[model samples]
Target: MKLRSLLFVPGDRPERFPKAVATGADALILDLEDSVVPERKPEARAAVRAWIEAPREDGPAVFVRVNPIDSDEVAADLEALAGLSLDGVVLPKAEGAESVAMLLDRLPGDYLVLPVASETPAAVFQLGTFAGVAGRLAGVTWGAEDLPASIGAATAREDDGSYTDPYRVVRALTLFGAHAAGVPAIETVFPDFRNLDALAAYAARGQRDGFTGMLAIHPTQVSVINDAFTPSEAEIAHAKAVIAAFDANPGAGALQLDGKMIDAPHLKSARRLLALVG
Candidate 1:
Protein backbone atom coordinates (compact mmCIF):
# COMPACT_ATOMS: atom_id res chain seq x y z
CA MET A 1 0.00 0.00 0.00
CA LYS A 2 1.12 3.59 -0.70
CA LEU A 3 0.84 4.70 2.93
CA ARG A 4 1.61 8.41 2.88
CA SER A 5 -1.49 9.09 4.96
CA LEU A 6 -3.66 6.57 6.82
CA LEU A 7 -6.86 8.17 8.11
CA PHE A 8 -8.94 6.75 10.93
CA VAL A 9 -12.73 6.51 10.91
CA PRO A 10 -14.86 5.19 13.73
CA GLY A 11 -16.13 1.79 12.68
CA ASP A 12 -19.47 2.51 14.34
CA ARG A 13 -19.98 5.47 12.04
CA PRO A 14 -20.62 3.53 8.86
CA GLU A 15 -22.04 6.67 7.28
CA ARG A 16 -18.59 8.26 7.25
CA PHE A 17 -16.87 5.36 5.49
CA PRO A 18 -17.30 6.84 2.04
CA LYS A 19 -16.52 10.30 3.38
CA ALA A 20 -13.13 9.04 4.50
CA VAL A 21 -12.52 7.45 1.09
CA ALA A 22 -13.45 10.72 -0.58
CA THR A 23 -10.65 12.46 1.36
CA GLY A 24 -8.23 10.64 -0.96
CA ALA A 25 -6.07 9.28 1.83
CA ASP A 26 -3.81 6.41 0.90
CA ALA A 27 -5.60 4.09 3.35
CA LEU A 28 -8.65 4.14 5.62
CA ILE A 29 -8.45 2.54 9.06
CA LEU A 30 -11.93 1.52 10.24
CA ASP A 31 -11.18 1.66 13.93
CA LEU A 32 -12.66 -1.15 16.03
CA GLU A 33 -10.60 -0.27 19.06
CA ASP A 34 -10.65 2.99 21.05
CA SER A 35 -13.13 4.72 18.79
CA VAL A 36 -16.03 2.31 19.44
CA VAL A 37 -17.67 1.92 22.82
CA PRO A 38 -17.85 -1.51 24.48
CA GLU A 39 -21.57 -1.91 23.84
CA ARG A 40 -21.24 -0.83 20.20
CA LYS A 41 -18.21 -2.95 19.22
CA PRO A 42 -20.25 -5.77 17.81
CA GLU A 43 -22.34 -3.40 15.77
CA ALA A 44 -19.22 -1.59 14.56
CA ARG A 45 -17.50 -4.82 13.58
CA ALA A 46 -20.55 -5.87 11.59
CA ALA A 47 -20.66 -2.45 9.95
CA VAL A 48 -16.98 -2.60 8.94
CA ARG A 49 -17.38 -6.07 7.46
CA ALA A 50 -20.47 -4.97 5.56
CA TRP A 51 -18.53 -2.14 3.94
CA ILE A 52 -15.61 -4.39 3.06
CA GLU A 53 -17.86 -7.01 1.46
CA ALA A 54 -19.61 -4.49 -0.77
CA PRO A 55 -16.55 -3.98 -3.05
CA ARG A 56 -16.39 -0.32 -3.95
CA GLU A 57 -14.23 0.26 -7.01
CA ASP A 58 -11.14 2.51 -6.69
CA GLY A 59 -11.59 3.00 -2.97
CA PRO A 60 -8.56 3.61 -0.75
CA ALA A 61 -6.85 0.60 0.81
CA VAL A 62 -8.88 -0.52 3.82
CA PHE A 63 -7.58 -1.57 7.25
CA VAL A 64 -9.35 -2.40 10.49
CA ARG A 65 -7.86 -1.64 13.91
CA VAL A 66 -8.70 -4.71 15.93
CA ASN A 67 -8.74 -4.72 19.71
CA PRO A 68 -5.28 -4.96 21.29
CA ILE A 69 -3.82 -8.45 20.98
CA ASP A 70 -3.92 -9.06 24.74
CA SER A 71 -7.57 -8.10 25.13
CA ASP A 72 -10.26 -10.80 25.25
CA GLU A 73 -12.25 -8.53 22.93
CA VAL A 74 -9.77 -9.33 20.15
CA ALA A 75 -11.26 -12.80 19.68
CA ALA A 76 -14.64 -11.39 18.75
CA ASP A 77 -12.96 -8.75 16.61
CA LEU A 78 -11.07 -11.36 14.59
CA GLU A 79 -14.01 -13.80 14.46
CA ALA A 80 -16.23 -11.08 13.04
CA LEU A 81 -13.58 -10.30 10.42
CA ALA A 82 -12.94 -13.88 9.31
CA GLY A 83 -12.32 -14.24 5.57
CA LEU A 84 -12.76 -10.53 4.92
CA SER A 85 -10.91 -8.75 2.14
CA LEU A 86 -8.95 -5.81 3.57
CA ASP A 87 -5.51 -4.25 3.32
CA GLY A 88 -4.39 -4.87 6.89
CA VAL A 89 -4.98 -4.87 10.64
CA VAL A 90 -3.69 -2.20 13.00
CA LEU A 91 -2.52 -4.09 16.07
CA PRO A 92 -2.36 -1.88 19.14
CA LYS A 93 -0.04 -2.23 22.17
CA ALA A 94 2.14 -4.64 20.27
CA GLU A 95 5.14 -5.77 22.38
CA GLY A 96 7.01 -7.88 19.86
CA ALA A 97 6.88 -10.26 16.90
CA GLU A 98 4.84 -12.76 18.90
CA SER A 99 2.03 -10.24 19.15
CA VAL A 100 2.06 -9.86 15.39
CA ALA A 101 2.13 -13.66 14.96
CA MET A 102 -0.76 -14.09 17.40
CA LEU A 103 -2.92 -11.78 15.35
CA LEU A 104 -1.76 -13.51 12.16
CA ASP A 105 -2.80 -16.93 13.50
CA ARG A 106 -6.43 -15.93 14.03
CA LEU A 107 -6.54 -14.01 10.78
CA PRO A 108 -7.49 -16.13 7.74
CA GLY A 109 -5.22 -14.54 5.18
CA ASP A 110 -1.75 -12.98 4.87
CA TYR A 111 -2.93 -9.47 5.60
CA LEU A 112 -0.50 -6.57 6.03
CA VAL A 113 -0.10 -5.37 9.62
CA LEU A 114 0.69 -1.92 11.05
CA PRO A 115 1.71 -2.42 14.66
CA VAL A 116 1.59 0.36 17.25
CA ALA A 117 4.95 -0.62 18.70
CA SER A 118 5.38 1.52 21.80
CA GLU A 119 2.22 1.70 23.85
CA THR A 120 2.98 -0.32 26.98
CA PRO A 121 6.18 0.31 28.89
CA ALA A 122 7.53 -3.15 28.08
CA ALA A 123 6.83 -2.51 24.42
CA VAL A 124 9.63 0.04 24.33
CA PHE A 125 12.20 -2.71 24.73
CA GLN A 126 10.52 -5.07 22.29
CA LEU A 127 10.66 -3.00 19.10
CA GLY A 128 13.59 -4.97 17.72
CA THR A 129 11.52 -8.16 17.47
CA PHE A 130 9.43 -6.76 14.60
CA ALA A 131 12.09 -7.89 12.13
CA GLY A 132 11.06 -11.48 12.72
CA VAL A 133 7.61 -10.70 11.33
CA ALA A 134 8.73 -8.24 8.65
CA GLY A 135 7.05 -10.18 5.85
CA ARG A 136 3.64 -9.66 7.49
CA LEU A 137 4.13 -5.93 8.07
CA ALA A 138 2.82 -3.00 6.06
CA GLY A 139 4.70 -0.61 8.33
CA VAL A 140 5.48 -0.02 12.00
CA THR A 141 3.98 2.86 13.97
CA TRP A 142 3.86 4.19 17.56
CA GLY A 143 1.13 5.79 19.67
CA ALA A 144 1.67 8.61 22.18
CA GLU A 145 -1.87 8.85 23.56
CA ASP A 146 -2.16 5.31 24.89
CA LEU A 147 1.40 5.18 26.14
CA PRO A 148 1.04 8.12 28.52
CA ALA A 149 -2.26 6.77 29.85
CA SER A 150 -0.73 3.33 30.23
CA ILE A 151 2.06 4.71 32.41
CA GLY A 152 -0.04 7.25 34.31
CA ALA A 153 1.75 10.26 32.93
CA ALA A 154 0.30 13.75 32.87
CA THR A 155 1.13 13.87 29.20
CA ALA A 156 3.51 12.47 26.63
CA ARG A 157 4.36 15.95 25.50
CA GLU A 158 5.95 18.92 27.22
CA ASP A 159 4.38 22.37 27.60
CA ASP A 160 5.56 23.27 24.12
CA GLY A 161 3.48 20.51 22.42
CA SER A 162 6.63 18.63 21.57
CA TYR A 163 7.11 15.13 22.92
CA THR A 164 9.05 14.99 26.17
CA ASP A 165 12.40 13.25 26.43
CA PRO A 166 11.05 9.77 27.18
CA TYR A 167 8.33 9.78 24.54
CA ARG A 168 10.91 11.23 22.17
CA VAL A 169 13.07 8.19 22.81
CA VAL A 170 10.10 5.91 22.18
CA ARG A 171 9.42 7.70 18.91
CA ALA A 172 13.03 7.39 17.82
CA LEU A 173 13.14 3.71 18.73
CA THR A 174 9.98 3.02 16.75
CA LEU A 175 11.42 4.85 13.73
CA PHE A 176 14.65 2.84 13.75
CA GLY A 177 12.83 -0.40 14.52
CA ALA A 178 10.60 0.03 11.49
CA HIS A 179 13.65 0.57 9.30
CA ALA A 180 15.40 -2.38 10.91
CA ALA A 181 12.41 -4.45 9.92
CA GLY A 182 12.72 -3.06 6.40
CA VAL A 183 9.31 -1.30 6.45
CA PRO A 184 8.10 2.27 6.34
CA ALA A 185 8.38 4.20 9.58
CA ILE A 186 4.94 5.76 10.12
CA GLU A 187 4.71 8.76 12.45
CA THR A 188 1.85 9.05 14.91
CA VAL A 189 -0.98 11.57 14.47
CA PHE A 190 -1.02 15.23 15.36
CA PRO A 191 -4.47 15.40 17.07
CA ASP A 192 -5.04 19.12 16.58
CA PHE A 193 -7.10 19.02 13.39
CA ARG A 194 -7.83 22.74 13.44
CA ASN A 195 -4.20 23.82 13.23
CA LEU A 196 -3.27 23.43 9.60
CA ASP A 197 -0.02 25.41 9.81
CA ALA A 198 1.33 23.39 12.72
CA LEU A 199 0.20 20.21 11.04
CA ALA A 200 2.15 21.19 7.94
CA ALA A 201 5.30 21.84 9.96
CA TYR A 202 4.85 18.60 11.95
CA ALA A 203 4.35 16.49 8.85
CA ALA A 204 7.35 18.08 7.17
CA ARG A 205 9.48 17.27 10.22
CA GLY A 206 8.34 13.65 10.07
CA GLN A 207 9.34 13.40 6.41
CA ARG A 208 12.67 15.06 7.16
CA ASP A 209 13.32 12.69 10.05
CA GLY A 210 12.94 9.57 7.85
CA PHE A 211 9.29 8.72 8.52
CA THR A 212 7.86 7.70 5.15
CA GLY A 213 4.25 8.29 6.25
CA MET A 214 2.02 9.55 9.06
CA LEU A 215 -1.31 8.71 10.70
CA ALA A 216 -4.28 11.06 10.32
CA ILE A 217 -7.06 11.39 12.87
CA HIS A 218 -9.17 13.73 10.71
CA PRO A 219 -9.85 14.06 7.00
CA THR A 220 -8.55 17.60 6.66
CA GLN A 221 -5.10 16.44 7.79
CA VAL A 222 -4.80 14.20 4.71
CA SER A 223 -3.84 16.83 2.15
CA VAL A 224 -1.29 18.40 4.50
CA ILE A 225 0.34 15.06 5.27
CA ASN A 226 0.36 14.13 1.57
CA ASP A 227 1.98 17.39 0.58
CA ALA A 228 4.57 17.12 3.34
CA PHE A 229 5.59 13.63 2.31
CA THR A 230 5.45 14.24 -1.42
CA PRO A 231 8.83 14.88 -3.03
CA SER A 232 9.16 18.42 -4.41
CA GLU A 233 10.31 19.16 -7.96
CA ALA A 234 13.78 20.05 -6.74
CA GLU A 235 13.93 16.92 -4.62
CA ILE A 236 12.87 14.71 -7.53
CA ALA A 237 15.42 16.33 -9.84
CA HIS A 238 18.22 15.92 -7.30
CA ALA A 239 17.27 12.31 -6.64
CA LYS A 240 17.30 11.63 -10.38
CA ALA A 241 20.66 13.32 -10.68
CA VAL A 242 22.10 11.19 -7.89
CA ILE A 243 20.85 8.04 -9.58
CA ALA A 244 22.29 9.14 -12.91
CA ALA A 245 25.66 9.89 -11.35
CA PHE A 246 25.75 6.50 -9.66
CA ASP A 247 24.80 4.81 -12.91
CA ALA A 248 27.54 6.59 -14.86
CA ASN A 249 30.24 5.61 -12.37
CA PRO A 250 29.49 1.98 -11.44
CA GLY A 251 31.32 0.71 -8.29
CA ALA A 252 32.58 4.20 -7.42
CA GLY A 253 32.76 4.64 -3.64
CA ALA A 254 32.60 8.45 -3.63
CA LEU A 255 31.38 10.87 -6.30
CA GLN A 256 31.25 14.66 -6.35
CA LEU A 257 27.68 16.00 -6.60
CA ASP A 258 27.13 19.80 -6.51
CA GLY A 259 30.58 20.25 -4.88
CA LYS A 260 29.77 17.73 -2.15
CA MET A 261 31.11 14.19 -1.80
CA ILE A 262 28.33 11.59 -2.00
CA ASP A 263 28.78 8.01 -1.01
CA ALA A 264 26.83 4.78 -0.47
CA PRO A 265 24.52 6.24 2.21
CA HIS A 266 23.64 9.23 0.04
CA LEU A 267 22.88 6.95 -2.90
CA LYS A 268 20.66 4.78 -0.69
CA SER A 269 18.73 7.83 0.54
CA ALA A 270 18.28 9.15 -2.99
CA ARG A 271 16.94 5.80 -4.15
CA ARG A 272 14.54 5.59 -1.22
CA LEU A 273 13.19 9.09 -1.95
CA LEU A 274 12.57 8.16 -5.58
CA ALA A 275 10.96 4.88 -4.55
CA LEU A 276 8.33 6.80 -2.61
CA VAL A 277 7.10 8.56 -5.77
CA GLY A 278 7.27 5.49 -8.02
Candidate 2:
Protein backbone atom coordinates (compact mmCIF):
# COMPACT_ATOMS: atom_id res chain seq x y z
CA MET A 1 0.00 0.00 0.00
CA LYS A 2 1.15 3.58 -0.65
CA LEU A 3 1.93 5.10 2.74
CA ARG A 4 3.60 8.34 1.69
CA SER A 5 2.07 9.98 4.76
CA LEU A 6 1.11 8.24 8.02
CA LEU A 7 -0.60 10.80 10.28
CA PHE A 8 -0.79 10.25 14.03
CA VAL A 9 -3.95 10.83 16.04
CA PRO A 10 -4.16 10.56 19.80
CA GLY A 11 -6.19 7.42 20.57
CA ASP A 12 -8.01 9.00 23.50
CA ARG A 13 -9.43 11.69 21.26
CA PRO A 14 -12.01 9.95 19.11
CA GLU A 15 -13.49 13.32 18.17
CA ARG A 16 -10.40 13.97 16.06
CA PHE A 17 -10.43 10.59 14.34
CA PRO A 18 -12.70 11.62 11.48
CA LYS A 19 -10.81 14.88 11.04
CA ALA A 20 -7.53 12.96 10.86
CA VAL A 21 -8.96 10.59 8.26
CA ALA A 22 -10.12 13.56 6.22
CA THR A 23 -6.63 15.09 6.13
CA GLY A 24 -5.73 13.19 2.92
CA ALA A 25 -3.06 11.13 4.64
CA ASP A 26 -2.45 7.75 3.08
CA ALA A 27 -2.78 6.16 6.51
CA LEU A 28 -3.70 7.14 10.08
CA ILE A 29 -1.99 5.84 13.19
CA LEU A 30 -4.30 5.98 16.20
CA ASP A 31 -1.60 6.25 18.79
CA LEU A 32 -2.44 4.34 21.96
CA GLU A 33 1.05 4.51 23.41
CA ASP A 34 2.93 7.76 23.97
CA SER A 35 -0.04 10.05 23.42
CA VAL A 36 -2.12 8.49 26.21
CA VAL A 37 -1.43 9.16 29.86
CA PRO A 38 -1.15 6.01 32.01
CA GLU A 39 -4.42 6.78 33.77
CA ARG A 40 -6.28 7.16 30.48
CA LYS A 41 -4.88 4.03 28.80
CA PRO A 42 -8.04 2.01 29.28
CA GLU A 43 -10.24 4.78 27.96
CA ALA A 44 -7.99 5.27 24.96
CA ARG A 45 -8.03 1.58 24.21
CA ALA A 46 -11.81 1.50 24.35
CA ALA A 47 -12.02 4.54 22.09
CA VAL A 48 -9.68 3.03 19.51
CA ARG A 49 -11.66 -0.23 19.54
CA ALA A 50 -14.94 1.55 19.00
CA TRP A 51 -13.53 3.60 16.12
CA ILE A 52 -12.13 0.51 14.45
CA GLU A 53 -15.42 -1.35 14.82
CA ALA A 54 -17.49 1.55 13.52
CA PRO A 55 -18.91 1.14 10.02
CA ARG A 56 -17.34 3.36 7.38
CA GLU A 57 -16.48 3.32 3.73
CA ASP A 58 -12.89 2.88 2.56
CA GLY A 59 -10.72 5.88 3.45
CA PRO A 60 -7.24 6.22 4.87
CA ALA A 61 -6.01 2.87 6.20
CA VAL A 62 -6.03 2.83 10.03
CA PHE A 63 -3.27 1.48 12.25
CA VAL A 64 -2.84 1.55 16.01
CA ARG A 65 0.43 2.27 17.77
CA VAL A 66 0.42 -0.11 20.70
CA ASN A 67 2.60 0.28 23.77
CA PRO A 68 6.05 -1.30 23.86
CA ILE A 69 6.33 -5.08 23.96
CA ASP A 70 7.82 -4.91 27.47
CA SER A 71 4.96 -2.81 28.81
CA ASP A 72 2.41 -4.48 31.07
CA GLU A 73 -0.42 -3.08 28.97
CA VAL A 74 0.70 -4.75 25.74
CA ALA A 75 -1.21 -7.97 26.40
CA ALA A 76 -4.42 -6.09 27.04
CA ASP A 77 -3.73 -3.95 23.96
CA LEU A 78 -3.42 -7.06 21.82
CA GLU A 79 -6.48 -8.61 23.41
CA ALA A 80 -8.53 -5.52 22.73
CA LEU A 81 -7.55 -5.54 19.05
CA ALA A 82 -8.47 -9.19 18.60
CA GLY A 83 -10.55 -9.75 15.44
CA LEU A 84 -10.90 -6.03 14.75
CA SER A 85 -10.16 -5.05 11.17
CA LEU A 86 -7.10 -2.84 10.97
CA ASP A 87 -4.53 -1.94 8.35
CA GLY A 88 -1.67 -2.70 10.75
CA VAL A 89 -0.11 -2.04 14.15
CA VAL A 90 2.79 0.34 14.66
CA LEU A 91 5.01 -1.68 16.98
CA PRO A 92 7.12 0.74 19.01
CA LYS A 93 10.49 0.22 20.64
CA ALA A 94 11.02 -3.08 18.91
CA GLU A 95 14.28 -4.57 20.14
CA GLY A 96 14.60 -7.38 17.61
CA ALA A 97 12.90 -9.89 15.38
CA GLU A 98 11.84 -11.64 18.59
CA SER A 99 9.67 -8.66 19.46
CA VAL A 100 7.83 -8.97 16.15
CA ALA A 101 7.53 -12.71 16.66
CA MET A 102 6.09 -12.25 20.13
CA LEU A 103 3.48 -9.82 18.83
CA LEU A 104 2.52 -12.17 15.98
CA ASP A 105 2.22 -15.08 18.39
CA ARG A 106 -0.49 -13.32 20.37
CA LEU A 107 -2.44 -11.98 17.40
CA PRO A 108 -4.97 -14.30 15.79
CA GLY A 109 -3.90 -14.21 12.15
CA ASP A 110 -1.76 -12.45 9.58
CA TYR A 111 -1.56 -8.67 10.11
CA LEU A 112 0.66 -6.02 8.65
CA VAL A 113 3.22 -4.58 11.10
CA LEU A 114 5.21 -1.38 10.92
CA PRO A 115 7.86 -1.47 13.61
CA VAL A 116 9.62 1.58 15.00
CA ALA A 117 12.89 -0.24 14.93
CA SER A 118 15.15 2.40 16.45
CA GLU A 119 13.79 3.88 19.65
CA THR A 120 16.05 2.36 22.30
CA PRO A 121 19.83 1.86 22.34
CA ALA A 122 19.52 -1.93 22.18
CA ALA A 123 17.06 -1.58 19.30
CA VAL A 124 19.80 0.05 17.23
CA PHE A 125 21.81 -3.19 17.24
CA GLN A 126 18.74 -5.26 16.43
CA LEU A 127 17.85 -3.39 13.21
CA GLY A 128 19.41 -6.01 10.96
CA THR A 129 17.15 -8.68 12.42
CA PHE A 130 14.22 -6.94 10.72
CA ALA A 131 15.13 -8.74 7.49
CA GLY A 132 13.94 -11.99 9.09
CA VAL A 133 10.48 -10.59 9.72
CA ALA A 134 9.95 -8.80 6.39
CA GLY A 135 7.08 -11.13 5.48
CA ARG A 136 4.92 -9.70 8.24
CA LEU A 137 6.15 -6.10 8.06
CA ALA A 138 4.42 -3.43 6.05
CA GLY A 139 7.43 -1.18 6.55
CA VAL A 140 10.15 -0.18 9.02
CA THR A 141 10.38 3.28 10.64
CA TRP A 142 12.65 4.99 13.18
CA GLY A 143 12.24 7.74 15.76
CA ALA A 144 14.67 10.30 17.22
CA GLU A 145 12.58 11.53 20.15
CA ASP A 146 12.58 8.43 22.35
CA LEU A 147 16.19 7.38 21.74
CA PRO A 148 17.64 10.61 23.09
CA ALA A 149 15.54 10.36 26.23
CA SER A 150 16.36 6.65 26.54
CA ILE A 151 20.08 7.41 26.37
CA GLY A 152 19.73 10.56 28.51
CA ALA A 153 20.91 12.89 25.79
CA ALA A 154 19.95 16.51 26.28
CA THR A 155 18.72 16.75 22.71
CA ALA A 156 18.65 14.63 19.57
CA ARG A 157 18.55 17.59 17.20
CA GLU A 158 20.68 20.66 16.67
CA ASP A 159 19.44 24.27 16.82
CA ASP A 160 18.39 23.97 13.18
CA GLY A 161 16.50 20.73 13.97
CA SER A 162 18.93 18.54 12.07
CA TYR A 163 20.02 15.36 13.78
CA THR A 164 23.41 15.26 15.47
CA ASP A 165 26.02 12.67 14.53
CA PRO A 166 24.81 9.98 16.94
CA TYR A 167 21.16 10.20 15.91
CA ARG A 168 22.26 10.52 12.27
CA VAL A 169 23.95 7.13 12.54
CA VAL A 170 20.77 5.63 13.97
CA ARG A 171 18.71 7.08 11.10
CA ALA A 172 21.13 5.67 8.52
CA LEU A 173 21.02 2.26 10.17
CA THR A 174 17.24 2.32 10.08
CA LEU A 175 17.28 3.20 6.36
CA PHE A 176 19.78 0.50 5.43
CA GLY A 177 18.08 -2.01 7.71
CA ALA A 178 14.74 -1.46 6.02
CA HIS A 179 16.41 -1.92 2.63
CA ALA A 180 17.97 -5.15 3.83
CA ALA A 181 14.56 -6.24 5.12
CA GLY A 182 13.05 -5.62 1.66
CA VAL A 183 10.53 -3.12 3.02
CA PRO A 184 9.95 0.61 2.87
CA ALA A 185 12.06 2.74 5.22
CA ILE A 186 9.64 5.33 6.52
CA GLU A 187 11.27 8.47 7.88
CA THR A 188 10.23 9.51 11.38
CA VAL A 189 8.22 12.62 12.18
CA PHE A 190 9.72 16.05 11.51
CA PRO A 191 8.20 17.31 14.83
CA ASP A 192 8.06 20.99 13.84
CA PHE A 193 4.74 21.07 12.07
CA ARG A 194 4.48 24.86 11.91
CA ASN A 195 7.48 25.28 9.63
CA LEU A 196 6.18 23.89 6.38
CA ASP A 197 9.38 24.85 4.57
CA ALA A 198 11.54 22.87 6.99
CA LEU A 199 9.14 19.99 6.86
CA ALA A 200 9.29 20.00 3.05
CA ALA A 201 13.07 20.10 3.11
CA TYR A 202 13.23 17.25 5.61
CA ALA A 203 10.85 15.11 3.59
CA ALA A 204 12.80 15.87 0.42
CA ARG A 205 15.99 14.76 2.13
CA GLY A 206 14.32 11.52 3.20
CA GLN A 207 13.19 10.86 -0.37
CA ARG A 208 16.65 11.61 -1.71
CA ASP A 209 18.12 9.17 0.78
CA GLY A 210 15.80 6.37 -0.39
CA PHE A 211 13.06 6.59 2.24
CA THR A 212 9.71 5.59 0.74
CA GLY A 213 7.54 7.49 3.22
CA MET A 214 7.51 9.64 6.35
CA LEU A 215 5.64 9.79 9.66
CA ALA A 216 3.64 12.92 10.55
CA ILE A 217 2.61 14.13 14.01
CA HIS A 218 0.04 16.49 12.52
CA PRO A 219 -2.40 16.69 9.61
CA THR A 220 -0.74 19.83 8.16
CA GLN A 221 2.27 17.67 7.33
CA VAL A 222 0.36 15.13 5.28
CA SER A 223 0.37 17.15 2.05
CA VAL A 224 4.02 18.01 2.38
CA ILE A 225 4.97 14.38 3.00
CA ASN A 226 2.88 13.12 0.12
CA ASP A 227 4.14 15.78 -2.27
CA ALA A 228 7.75 15.18 -1.33
CA PHE A 229 7.48 11.43 -1.85
CA THR A 230 5.50 11.53 -5.05
CA PRO A 231 7.65 11.54 -8.17
CA SER A 232 7.32 14.70 -10.18
CA GLU A 233 6.52 14.74 -13.90
CA ALA A 234 10.14 15.59 -14.70
CA GLU A 235 11.38 12.65 -12.65
CA ILE A 236 8.89 10.28 -14.26
CA ALA A 237 9.86 11.47 -17.72
CA HIS A 238 13.55 11.02 -17.06
CA ALA A 239 12.94 7.57 -15.60
CA LYS A 240 10.96 6.60 -18.68
CA ALA A 241 13.73 7.95 -20.92
CA VAL A 242 16.30 5.93 -19.04
CA ILE A 243 14.24 2.77 -19.41
CA ALA A 244 13.72 3.43 -23.12
CA ALA A 245 17.44 3.99 -23.66
CA PHE A 246 18.21 0.59 -22.13
CA ASP A 247 15.46 -1.10 -24.12
CA ALA A 248 16.56 0.45 -27.40
CA ASN A 249 20.12 -0.68 -26.84
CA PRO A 250 19.54 -4.18 -25.50
CA GLY A 251 22.89 -5.52 -26.69
CA ALA A 252 24.87 -2.72 -25.04
CA GLY A 253 25.74 -3.00 -21.35
CA ALA A 254 25.88 0.78 -20.95
CA LEU A 255 24.35 3.76 -22.70
CA GLN A 256 24.42 7.54 -22.59
CA LEU A 257 21.48 9.46 -21.09
CA ASP A 258 21.37 13.26 -20.66
CA GLY A 259 25.15 13.32 -21.25
CA LYS A 260 25.81 10.87 -18.42
CA MET A 261 26.62 7.17 -18.48
CA ILE A 262 23.52 5.03 -17.83
CA ASP A 263 24.40 1.53 -16.71
CA ALA A 264 22.60 -1.51 -15.36
CA PRO A 265 22.22 0.08 -11.94
CA HIS A 266 20.65 3.20 -13.44
CA LEU A 267 18.29 1.04 -15.47
CA LYS A 268 17.29 -0.84 -12.33
CA SER A 269 16.59 2.41 -10.47
CA ALA A 270 14.54 3.72 -13.38
CA ARG A 271 12.40 0.59 -13.38
CA ARG A 272 11.96 0.78 -9.63
CA LEU A 273 10.88 4.44 -9.80
CA LEU A 274 8.35 3.65 -12.47
CA ALA A 275 7.08 0.73 -10.42
CA LEU A 276 6.62 3.02 -7.44
CA VAL A 277 4.53 5.44 -9.49
CA GLY A 278 2.40 2.59 -10.80
Pairs that collide, model 2: none
Candidate no. 1 TM-score: 0.98
For residue 75, what is the lDDT in candidate 2? 89
Per-model clash counts, in order, read: 0, 0
Q: Candidate 2: where is the Cα deviation over 4 Å?
A: none
lDDT at 191, model 2: 81
**What pairs collide in candidate 1?**
none
> What tens digits encode model 2's per-residue C-alpha lDDT throughout 69-163?
88999988998899999989999999878899888888867689999999999999999898888999989999999999998999999998899
